[model samples]
Target: MMKRITKLVMVIFLLTGISTVNGQDKYGTEPKKCQQNLSLFHESVKAKNFEGAYENWKWCFDNCPKASLYVYSDGIKIAENRYKTGDKTAAAKLINDIYTQRIKHFPKNLGKVYSDWAKSLIKIGATKDQVFEKLDTAFKADPTGMSIKNLANFFQEVTDRNKDTNVQKVFDTYDDVVEGVNNKIDKLTKQSDVINAKDSLGKTLTSKEVKKRKNIGINLTALGQVEGVLDRIISKVATCDRLIPLYQKNFEAHKTDSKWLRRAVSRLFSKECTEDALYPKMVEAWVTSDPSPKAYIFYAGILEKRGEKKKALEFRKKAIDLETDPYKKADYLYRIARTMYGSSAVSYARKALKHRPNMGKAYLLIARMYAKSANSCGTDEISKRMVYVAAVNKARRAKAVDPSITSKANGHIRSYSAQFPSKKILFVAGVKSGSRHKVGCWIGETVTVP
Candidate 1:
């Protein structure tokens, strides 16, 4: 530094035209152009311009060495985009390079980009070990993320991808594809995580979390190893005893996030260990507190899943009444039809079709309702078989409107093709007549696990 100062002084004294890059920091602070390039990179991604993203990202990475961490996320996103959109080799190269060069920056964004990128990898069918490895790396890099445990827990189920019979039946409908490199991570496949998943919420652990734990117990019911999952959920809820009042007070806070709460409800329903005395109240809490269409629908769906047809129908109707989304309202109506499956269900399904004329699921429901008549599950003759043809026609129309549900819609059509119903039709309404009697009847007459 002294030598440079002396040189500068001598240059000025000698009146020489010695020059230097003014305003440039010797420590390599990024230039404004780098920021501009990064912005452009984001814009290109938003615009789906893959070519532009690579170019802009390249410029940003070259100019902003210190901010290379930021580029890693973008690079990963572009790589996924490339893979999903059909540039397999290029996508693989991009993922490999970004992962290699930015290993230290793995947890830089933590949740926003990092989690999403991991989800994308899962969508591509990443193996469980691979996803866990990445998440483990992320935790090692920045274990401070509020969702660290939550993400870990979420990925625990990746292996159960096959368990979603519904997703498997309608897999082709949703455009879920992540090509190129394999995603070995599978969620829902791992053992339950014991790590504390501190909620990312700014508020204290919410009544919502309590409710969430409450529901987790429910969702664990009937699944294999039900006792263990139920115990875990009960433990979580018990930990929040002091937070019960807060959970009660902040019930309204959940209007903004009812889906999460409903998920907890579903989880709770899955658990078989819930106190019998607490069951009705817990179900009521979900139904009344989560008044949103989705919450109501999910709650009703949970009841329907447990073969509580009357309650399911009621909740389904409530969802239909609360929902403002035309599509969603139709969806609820179809759910109602799925539960009731008579003229009443048919009426709602038609109403749903009327509201969202293009919805294929509604048409599928119409067919299912038609097939309900032929359902041998009923002690009396099933609803009626002739109506199924009309239902199939409606389902076909729905498929015409939205091609995605074509497979399921087609399934509905084929379901009628076979006159026999493969599944049971629990006299759901009969169960509501009285609890003890219904329990006895269900125990005596209902189907059991095969």
Candidate 2:
């Protein structure tokens, strides 16, 4: 009888423990009730029944504001439905409330939340300055969280508002957004390369991989469009004439600011404003401030201009020697390639690839060099066109290894393929299309005859 009583007690204890565990929740919501409400609202959302989900979702939201991130997410859907029904004021308020609660509960998502808030404000026809304030906050908090459209809009707004007084701000924001865009493209390209590698040697990709590739391609195209828009908007104020004076005026204030100096020098150099005295001054300031490889590269350019060939070469070599990061080293090498001629450019490009195999731009550069030297690379017409074949091969390899430059590689492929030796030429040379032919001269790359 006593043993039976002990077993009963143990069963009661187990049941009590289970009840206690089941009752507690992350946000201290009554588990049974919250679960019922959350499930009902989630199902309604899935069913597109915002009306059906509204009451339960609101109840869960008010009762357990910290229940889950989905509470706020679902709230947006509910609010949107409210707006569609002709209650814009209430909808806007509710949307704001949802964002506020989301930030309160999930502070780590602050950056993205602010960007979403800014976008929402923009959609509702907020004033340019108001929208700019939110966007600036978002960018300052985390530029990476912003979408390409938002970033472009942000820069446009800044330009519109402060075009006369603060051109530097416009320039700085442009640089930031461009870097962010390129970084995003690089990431997407690397992802594509991985997915592409999974396909068989002679077979098609799986359905899942195909879908993934399509999504990446769509995103890259969208980003490219946004970049075009950004350039157009910034071009109004970033003209060489405007840039030179504006930079000259502020040079003194920002001379010690290495980041600012580097950007200023790079911009001036890209605009071919190097003939201006300000360009050399900025470059010298940059070197004095940082003395990094980037600064040294600029200084080297000045030396070359002054006809100090030996000094320029030494400075260039010093920059390469000082750069420790493989990626940075590769970038320096690629820059050197740009300034070089003939086979020297190809050699430096090849060296850059050694340090960073994913530098697709380097491959494109090498291909261009080969195409330019087609007449010099071979003694005969067929042999000269074979250099185009070599260029096309390099371009194809670039696309295979880095999807970020796939469009560029495809362009090179098209241009070179059109210039390829006709079948008649191949026949006359007694070379088959698939047979390898050596491209003599400085470019020793073997290419398939076409």
Candidate 3:
């Protein structure tokens, strides 16, 4: 009986020991399966199931970093693809092998993978130091890519930020507290604060420093960012104010393409485009980069806004000359003849008909000009009547050609007819009875103050 009890106790110990061993190995058995999964990972990649490939690769790297080729090679390739497609998760998973457990295994290519992560951080607006920290981590793991030049460039930015920068002040302050370690013991921490970090600002600062640092500020201001800053404050600011010149200054520096400039201009004009100081040079740059007839048209409008009508008309004519189609050119001529002075109206109207024979407005312009010219003759009754009759006939023809002009042409006909009723000088000479200008033809009685 004692032998039987001893055997039972021994049997109980054996079962308990087996149970304890399994409990100790609870998380340890994962890697063997991870390696088996990694063996199938390349097939997943070949099958174009990138998610499966990444998942398996991630598991293998974390669980079994010794799976030599998969951790460094396949993981990096997928991470790059992740970066491009904006698949942050996929990208993180792909690089997680190099970043996490397997970094110590392959030290050389590991640093590059961290550099790649820093690049990703930059796209998302990480600060310079944050980027450098990751960059340093990569260098620590694999120092191959940690170039002397990169260190120098980054360190230069920090030093420059602390210097007496005469760049445009943002008028806003950003508080930054930086801690520096004084010695190699890595024990002592140095602390400092900086104020009013003058990043690219909208202030069109007129500094003696302006000429030198303008390019640096402009460089920081992207083609898009420059456009945005100019948009917000262009209206509330003055034209001949200090800022006017910087628009021209920066325009000269840009290697702008037509599409970007077009969008930028459209954005600027959507706000206070009529501001005298801004539009002229803005339009100038548009023409400078790409001189289309449309560019000249916009420039002409800007000139007109600045009360430079003569310059405006010159650009308008340039637009007309640049026009390829004769019909459009005729329209341009009509605009010039009607709105501007001299005896060109009759001739331009005739030319317009010659180019576009069915043009109705041409007949109206010619008739009006002739009627105007005729009535101006003081004593020539026959010529005046003849011109009046000619004017009436042409006005009638315009009415016949296009009914849309009849209402307008009739008003012109009535006004000219009443203005020169007799076309004869009134007998009284010293002073005209009514001073010549009349305010007749009221539909309602006028109000008089008592």
Candidate 4:
């Protein structure tokens, strides 16, 4: 008798379109209808019939909010189409809704979703605070997932908000963004290197590989732009005058903190603040606390500044040996080269090339070294001008290897080419324009007379 009564009540509830809370599934009550709508919407969206998809999509969205992630993803496409067709207000609202619901149902890729949301907000002329709110969340969740442009914009927002009262926060944000960008660039560079090597061996790439190479190039270009923006934004506040006092004030508190010491040392070194009284003290503390490769490099710089060349080179070698990453090792070699002169500097730059063949800065450094030595390199005007030929050759190589430095390398090429031997001078010296000539002295590079 009890079983019969329960069955009757359940039948009545079903007939009356009522379901207990515990009995509800992700597809909601009347799941067959909800699933039908989901299928109908999906098919319509696939056919690019957004108008046909809309009603059914809305039904699924309202009735079965957690049915599937595709509901929101496909909805975004519909909304974007609408946005492009002049349904500005409604489309933006729907897109925001999709982002919110997608995040609620599927929390994966939270950072990317928030960044996309922020970008959408920007397009609709949203206030800075509104845009920043989304960006801040995105940056905190997963900075690596954010686009290069978004990362740079986030840093700018951070700087504007904290520059006056909390300048350290601004600096920290800059470091974080730069580190993220460098990490991404490093990964892409390794992949690009592999593709480049295969191409050099005359192996044909697949369609997918070719597309990937193109994308990597585009991304590298964007990342390079972001880096330039970051430097420009930080340069104003990162001067030695500003950095000296800032570090001086924080040194007492951060002396024993290795991470803090490293950043301080790096910033000071980059700003060329090594002559200050506080620099040595900070370096000593940093080395004592953590004698890492970078610490040793800074220590070497100080030693060289104090006129202890032999000791400096010893520490630089120590730094090089301690570093395990070939890229970092190359960077340290370049830094050491920057402090040297003439042939020695060129030698160290070449060593850097052995580790990272795509390093354009090393080539640029060599070109500058050769140009500076032109006067001392030759006794005659024609011979002196031949050094510029070698310099131009190096600048051209720099431009070819690294797209990021194209403009800078072109400038160098132009400057060097201007100093090429005049037509009459070449004739008087019996040097044909296309004839090979060896530049003597420190730079012994052979180049065609131009």
TM-score of each: 0.38, 0.81, 0.29, 0.80
Winning candidate number (lDDT): 4
Poorest stretch of ten by lDDT in candidate 2: 21-30
RMSD of 4: 7.8
lDDT of 2 by residue, 1-450 (tens): 999999999999999988776557453557678878988998899898998899999988888777777798788888778877857887888887888788888786555678888877766666777777878888887766677678777777888878898888888887887777777776786677677556635557879889998888777766555556777897778778998989988888998999999888887877677888888888899999999997888898898899998998898889999999777788888998988888899899999988877688899999999999999988999889899988998898887666556767888999999999998888877878888889989899787776
Q: Could you tell me the C-alpha RMSD of candidate 2 in Å?
A: 5.6
The local lDDT score (0 to 100) that residue 121 gets in candidate 3 is 60
Which wins on TM-score, candidate 1 or candidate 4? Answer: 4
Model 3: per-residue lDDT, tens digit, 114-178? Answer: 76666656654557887778766764554334333333333333334532342112111000100
lDDT score of residue 138 within candidate 4: 93
Clashes (backbone N, CA, C under 3 Å), per candidate, total 38, 0, 0, 0
Against the reference, the lDDT scores of all candidates come to 0.50, 0.82, 0.52, 0.85
lDDT of 3: 0.52
